[model samples]
Target: MENNLKNRREFLKEMSVFAGATTFLASIPWMKAFAGSDGSAMAPSDRVRIGVVGVGDRGRALLMNMQQIENVEIIAVCDNYEPNYKRAIELTAGKAKAFYDHREMLEMKDLDGVIVATPLHEHAHVVVDFLKAGIHVFCEKSMARTLEDSKWMVDVQKETGKILQIGHQRLFNPVYLNALDRVRAGEIGQITQVRAYWHRNSNWRRAVPSPELERKINWRLYTEYSAGLMTELASHQVQVANWFLDKIPTRVMGSGSICYWNDGREVYDHVALVYDYDNGVKCLYDSMIANKHYGLEEQIQGDKGTIEPEINRIYSENPPAAPGIRQLLHSIEKGIFETIPIGGASWVPETAVPYRGQIIAPYDNNDTFLQLVGYVQAIRNGKPWKNLLREGYHATVAALLGLQAMDTNQILEWPAEYVMEKDL
Candidate 1:
């Protein structure tokens, strides 16, 4: 037993070091200043007791981040898979109780919140159950598999008045937050269009482990457990577009195909979507699996400027014109010297500028930790959660609509009664 405990501690230490390295490399300039030596400004005694459900890939990552935050405790962990359950126990250094069923974990009176990292399809059911149990939830995104399920989660959240923060980590990313502020502040002028794409080379192939474990590990490739690229990848971009536009998409149209990998996977390997907002703005998005040369990119193009959140690039179409002696000489010797376009109505040159925007709440790469901190802080301060349940519902709905558009080969419209739908 002592040896087991020692090994668990060693595993946690290794995981912590790995997470720290990733967090360091992916660090955002704005977030670094906000992350103190001991994480944020929260008191250690006020730590939120957390129970994590579904200890899969994302679940383990969340566990590592939670460990870094000072005012947070992993009280319990639940996973149906025995290996994952054991792994979660090891990851938490045996500090958290383990359970096969999430319901059993939720029954623990000490837990102040829960992190739902279950498969996409089970998101709504598990989140609603925990919310109804009067426990705060931080569920991973694409919140649900279907539109009906997403709406249902929203309704239950409203009824329970519990904090339901969906895990769209990008929403809390410092760079994205900075871009959003610039968009909202009109630095990018009127956002006429958004272009986003995520491309990857090679078939999204995984080892086939005895048919049973096939669905267990790579649930993403199957429709039963996941919604493929549309939900897994495009959902993040859709949420960002929504946040920038400050409105949900009115209509969605798209298509997808399984051109690259023919591994008996039900979901498409590539997908593209066009979301039309009520204000006439549009978001064009595409994801491909055959080639990733372009990698992942998102550009918010406006009349005045463009912002690329991923690259941290911001540029203005209107640049300051040259003046004084240079302008005078060019005007005098038109034949000898070529006329340069200056900042005027007729000629505008795109020029990159330092991003001077600020995020509403600065996020570092440790956003997951910051979000957990925020949730715990809100609970301790008796304040409402900054990330509301409706946001998660909307993000999920948009993702599901994108999938529907692809499947039905028609534009999917958001129903008026979407908010009132009951969870399945």
Candidate 2:
């Protein structure tokens, strides 16, 4: 018990430093920051207690990930819907308190942090409350549904020094990190273009048991609540694009329509977008709910090679020779770039696989779990992850800008407000 009291004091001291004042929040020992360094076994007294708001599909997934982390305790779970609320409580094995309203959950006073996994449109409101309470927040992308709301979240995070980690799981994926390292090391040569796509065959709707639940259930199809494919899916690829390019787009143009799924959905079922960076790099992106052929991919192309982190492959435009005497012997055996003509009829075109690639790293990269662990660690240490908030905001604004272009039928200029955060 004495150890618990000392832990509480240390936690408050850390938090007071964050708030720029010594006034501590409720001194519940459960709110103590984990005393262990990275990967250390945290006793219950040393665990960072967290509250989760909006236990929907994504929220529940995040909750499950949190349960896998031994150093974190989910002291509270919040959801407006009864089914989600019950499922989340069951997942917690009834160890957590349940609240229909997130605000009530915030009143618990023992929470060191909160995860805001509400719909994109609902992010700003829920996240702002957590920030105001001096609670660290992990908000899922695309930061918020609107530009104003996204900016508000960023601004509040700046005002309060609490850790604000937006969920862009690709930022933590080892495949992506290795690819990025290679790119930075000029393994892919000069990056010239990037192409990404997300394809699905479903209408992206929920089966509403009652007509009244239509708007609530299929919020992604509604313009008021969601931006459909762009915000829901493209947000991931767009973020990866920006991170690789190391800059935000200077301008954006796009077109989207519900040409296939004309089921009274306000948002588009297909979208084609192009983002132009000031450095003359272009990112080509497209998505469709009418086709599942490609599934989803982000292809980064450069002069010497191409990287597809999705498949953990890097294809060299020119495969270098094997080192030492074997390479010299192989070169002596065959003429460079000369095709042996005996394999197929001259009139018939025979296709042999042209490009060869090697897997740089072969680990089952669990991106979502990495993202959660990052948030927990940052919160436990009382520090924010560097530039994480800006990554989410940049992508959200880019998507919004593209939507404007699609709506206006003209290229839209990127907003200067984003320039404050984006180094570009």
Candidate 3:
């Protein structure tokens, strides 16, 4: 444990230096908050008091990650669900106060920030209230179930001038940070295409203790509570595409159907979407619950190489020569220019390169942990990272638009109503 802590401190020190670089900060402006003005790690005395709402799966995960960071206190937890509330209290080891209603917890005056990991439909309402109350927020992704709600949340944050960080962990991930550096440095050349997908065989449901708790326990499988695969899963990958390309889709087209998991679920079991960006860049996305093969991946392809962030691999367009070719080159350099008969297969099929590729980034701690730390840092500094909300907003709008396109069987243009003239 001590060794891990030491490594984490060292890694954070290195990242602080990396984040302080002018070129890297210019490209990823949000990372500027990662470094202190004095170029030192956040002091342990800079403690942050935190509250968590909707203490379910994602909320618990965030709690666990937050606890790992020094000087962070889980002051309070709120949940309407009994099981989750109990679990959260236990997870905090009884250190945090528990409340059935978020409003009651909001009455507490010491919260530096609140994490909203509520269901899709609850995000806007819960987050807006907290922001209006002058508390910083770290809401889970997709912003909200509806575009209007999502936009309204962004507006509320702007009005309040409090930190509103959408839970896009990749934004704080070292692997993705390194990949972004390479992308900006033209290591992969100009990005030509982007593709991302998530696949799993499970029904995407929780085991309900009773029939009465079905709706509350497994809200993800229903349309009234969630957009299912698109908002919950695709939104994360879509955000990655937006961040990497630094462009949101101007238009999107797609299709979806409940081909599998036909057990009374209101949402699609599979979906395929195509998002069109400026300069003819396209992001093709799809997700399915019938198969787990091809799992989750976001492939950013450029003229020179391809980056798969999930697996931390970069495949170059040009690979090194074989041993025989190198030997031939060696011979030629020594003045052995004998002509050899070129005999090979008449039809050589072109395929993906055999090279497994190189690791794109160094091993690091959990991205969620890093992101939580950034949130606290932003709170301490009283400065919101530029365009961070914009990234979340664009991705949420794109995902909702993709669902609209899929349902209507037509291409959907980006809605002008939600487009921000400037970053908030």
lDDT per residue as tens, model 3, 1-424: 6676676677777777767655775457667655644223456667789999988989999988887766789999999898899999999999999988888766788888999999989999999989888889999997999988998998898898988999988888878888888898899999999999999999888999999888888899888888889998999999999888988789999999999899999999999999999789999999999999899999999999999999999988987665556667777899887663333433568657555999887667488878887887788777787778887788789888898899889998897888865453
Best first by lDDT, ranked: 3, 2, 1
Which lDDT tens digits does candidate 2 get at residues 1-424? 5565455445434432332221221121211222223343356665889888988889998998887665688999988888888998998999999998988866677899988888779999999988988899999888888888888988898899888888888876657866877788788999999999999999898888899889988888999999888888888898899988888899999999888988898999999999999989999999999899888988999999999988889989877643444455565678554333342344556558544588866655667876787788787678786667778888888887788789789998898886646322
Of the candidates numbered 1 and 2, which has the greater TM-score value? 2
Number of colliding residue pairs in each model: 1, 0, 0
Comparison by TM-score, 2 against 3, better one: 3
Best by TM-score: 3
Q: Give Cα-based local distance difference scores for all models.
A: 0.73, 0.79, 0.85
Top of the candidates by lDDT: 3
**What is the TM-score (0 to 1) of candidate 2?**
0.83
lDDT (Cα, 0-100) at 390 in candidate 3: 83
Which order, best to worst by TM-score?
Answer: 3, 2, 1
lDDT of 2 at 204: 90
- TM-scores, all candidates, are 0.80, 0.83, 0.90
